[model samples]
Target: MNEERIIELEIRQAYQEDLLQALNSVVAEQQKQIGKLEETCKLLHDKLKSLARAEPSPGLADERPPHY
Candidate 1:
């Protein structure tokens, strides 16, 4: 009965270790994806700024000067 209990405990420990490893891997992947998304957003923001600098946007009818 003691030997059986030891084996069962070992199996549970191994299972828990495997689960922790899998969770770590998932978190790492999510972090990499977030980093990539941030980079893409920054690039897009830069592109928008460049475009705005290159040309004026159209809707300026009710205009106010800097003094206003």
Candidate 2:
């Protein structure tokens, strides 16, 4: 009985180890994707800011059309 219990424990440990490794890999990939997304967001924000700066301020030039 003791030997059987030991074997069962070993099997459980092995499965746990495999699960832990899989979880670690998934987390690492998610982190890398998050980093990439953050970089893209920053670039888009900067481009928008630059475009806003280059555009004319709200005034006669930006009036709505007569249809509106």
Candidate 3:
């Protein structure tokens, strides 16, 4: 009975190790994706900033229709 119990424990440990490795891989992949998304957001933010600086800010609310 003791030998059987040891074998069972070993099997469980192996499965646990495999699961842990799979989880680690998934976490690593997610981290990489997060980094890419952050970089993309930064780039878009910079582009928007540049565009805002280049555009003229005309007040549309103060203008009346040409027909009036």
Model 2 stretches astray by more than 4 angstroms: 57-62
In the range 1-68, model 1's lDDT, one tens digit per residue, is 99999999999999999999999999999999999999999999999999999997866776766797
Question: What is the descending TM-score order?
Answer: 2, 3, 1
lDDT of 3: 0.96
TM-score, model 2 to reference: 0.84
In order of appearance, the predictions have TM-scores of: 0.71, 0.84, 0.82
Clashing pairs in 2: none
- TM-score for candidate 3: 0.82
Worst 10 residues of 1 by lDDT: 57-66
Model 1 regions lying over 4 Å from their true place: 1-3, 60-68
lDDT of 3 by residue, 1-68 (tens): 99999999999999999999999999999999999999999999999999889995668997888999
Preferred candidate (TM-score higher): 1 or 2: 2
Q: TM-score: which is higher, 1 or 3? A: 3
Q: What lDDT score is found at residue 42 in candidate 2?
A: 100
